[model samples]
Target: MDNKAIATDVLAAVGGKENVTYVTHCVTRLRFNLKDSGLADRDVIEKIPGVIGVQEAGGQYQVIIGTNVGQVYDEVCRVGGFAHETAVMPDKDSVGKKSILSSMLGTIIGCIMPLIPILIGTGLGKCILMIIQLAGIASSDTSMAFYVFSFVFDAGFTFLPVFTAIAAAKHFGSNQLMAALMGCALLHPNWTSLVSAADPKFIGDMFGIPLYGMSYASSLIPAILIVWVMSKLEGFLNAKLPELVRGMLTPLITLLIMTPLSFLLLAPAMGYLAVALGDALLTIYNAGGGVVIALICFVYPWMVVTGTHSTLAIAGMQLMAQTGYDPFSRTLPLVANMSQGAAALACALRTKNKKFRSTCLSTAFTVFFAGVSEPVIYGVTLRLKRPMWAVMIGSAAGGLVAGIFALKAYTWMTPSVINVAMWIGGDGLNNLFVAIAAMVVSAIVSFIATLLIGFEDPTSDEVEEGADYQL
Candidate 1:
């Protein structure tokens, strides 16, 4: 279906555009903050042609649309005439009533969801480069091809603050350009040079406060915190200043005040918190070992349902910065995705309904190859009820093996079969073998379980017409 038609169906399912307070999308879902959640037809939305499923969680109505969500989101914005920045902001009354935890999760999702496309693209580029380097196709790391490819792949993570700050500003109702400049300040050549210096004294002082130099490259928490504060400061300044000078003066004053504060307080504080959280998670993984990993895999689908899976990305990034690799974050998720896909494929093989079978096959391919699992999970597994257990069981089996082998990813990438190449250089052949083993094991186990467990085939009404469905 065309984007406009999809948008129209989506808007109508969600009780029309008037009911929408805001709309945004992550990698595979369109998240909507509705004025009245009751007005939305959840069952109807789930059955929409392009929609994978519907989720009401984290105080938002989420429509799962697989990987094409970005295109649909753009169309939704156009059709609804809702500004992207304002679309995500909650109603004023609802804001004060939200719990601290909900507010924090919402902010994190807002800031990070916008960056997923770039993150995935750069991550895959890095993976491809690694494979080429490993194959001796690009022998010299010093070669121009190597440098160019490396920079192209590495720049996204290396300069994450710039992207994150802009997103956070939009989320927090701040000046985007000013927020972007604040991010640039964190990565400024002068600041970076001081931080790179061997001696502590080289960092000097900023406005009577000591500058404890630290690199903000690939850092998430610091950029988010800095921008949140900047938003508040900008709002205050804009309101208090005269209309004529406000545009110019608000940003200038906000930057001057925030830059010093960031260097002196925000960066250090958030950096420590991020480290502590990452360390705590690492400690838990080390202590619990395979059992913990298995449990994570078992419950992962539920996390995705609750819209809390994005939290893992934040933690994983921090862990990667602190340590050279992230073992806990991406490993089990990869297995779970493959398992979900496997279950869907099994359903495809067993189902008599040609249309439903076709959808199952397509979604299976999308999940297994592209690592987008929502379609298979929501459209098939959860819809069938029996396959979800099979997926979890298979995922747990794979997670156990992964944890026992201590499989790790050297870089931040979306966990998928395509990302298996990333395991090559850092951890040697054993880790690569383990990753492959995890995929194979999960797929086989889930396939077998789904076939044995069985599910009721969809009725005639449930089947839709479309051979070209791409999940």
Candidate 2:
């Protein structure tokens, strides 16, 4: 796609390098913290070759560039003279101006989006291993393959804090090695011993203050908090200490101060919030049933648009761990993805513009196969507007059917046609049947809905795909 030319064009469209404050990329988008967001022209940027779309959310100017975004990102850095991964944090003066909601959304996406590949990989591995058991090819309890895979998913979850801490440290501009050490300290054998005790509270005293403990493996918030505090502490030490001793003492003092404080204060005080979030989702699902399921699926695309859906993806794991099967999080995303694909497929059929039609067709295939919805979302549905509503409506229809049939996902893979094996759950082929039916329903509904609610078809032969701000 001529990345060099695209990068050169992108720099000019976004007001050149002088307006760029920070820059990074996720799996599919080039993220930018702009000196003034208004200075960037979204429409102009989307027309750049190799650009899929653009989104300004979570306080960042995001240029959607598909799977090869990393290549484009490096080119962008070179063309703009912006350093790679050098403190992507927004200016401190403007940080406080963000609403609490935007701040949380920003933090979650920044820290967790980088971990999506690990989560998806582990989930699919487990799903494949489970299939071997169901096929009677392996004894889940005794087979060598089972033994190898049994802990594969758990290993990802168990050391999630370490992974998450590294991501958080990078985002918050802290030393990643120190963050990794802090994560390990949280899961230290000594701490494990204390947590395994019958009564964890007041079992040990630190300066006459009672120490309470819990297993930090598979936990999320504590690692993020510790790393953030460490960043601040390390920064202070860097400024105050002499250059010779700074490196030696910075990490040492940061770890010593943050580690115990994390266990005694952060984990003890706030770690349960993650558990509570899982419980709250469960409670809400139980109360609302199929309607709640429908709602989650319906809103999930919007969540993806803002990159907030990453949290729910992980939350699904929490649900599965607690119940041994997840009915809520994992099930409907598949439905929604197919629904998006359906809407885009309809657009491909309905559009007279051949280029836009091709764009629509490719995006539909991406969602149906690769399970990525961003191309269709930014490149098609949201641009067309009516089709987006069709996607949500279709998802609601499918989600209702799925929830009514108690369709549960046994694994954590991104919901898509290719990953249907993920539906083999406690209910066996019944859930699998339900998943198939749900996908069919979502697609048919969205396709029909899109055709019915026709959009303003692009008239230009040179129809570059996308929309940034509205239906």
Best by lDDT: 1
Q: Name the lDDT value of residue 185 in candidate 1.
A: 88
Candidate 1: misplaced stretches above 4 Å?
A: 15-19, 84-88, 140-142, 198-205, 464-470
Clashes of 1: 1
- Which sections of candidate 2 miss by over 4 Å? 15-21, 77-91, 139-142, 200-203, 317-326, 351-354, 460-471
Cα lDDT tens digits, model 1, 1-471, are: 677888889999898988877778988889887777788998788667887677766666888887888899999999998887653455665565556876677678768888887887887888888777777788345579888878887888888889989988877777788888888988999878877874633377677766776777888889999999987787788779999998789878887898789988898788778878989999998998888998899888778766777788778878877786888888867888989899988999999988888789888888878888787777788878999989989999899988888888877777787778767656457888988998899889999999999999987576643222445
lDDT of 2 by residue, 59-129 (tens): 66788778677788889888887755445555665566666876666666677767778878987888778
Candidate 1 backbone collisions, by pair: 22-87
Q: Lowest-scoring 10 consecutive residues by lDDT in candidate 1? A: 462-471
Q: Name the lDDT of candidate 1.
A: 0.81
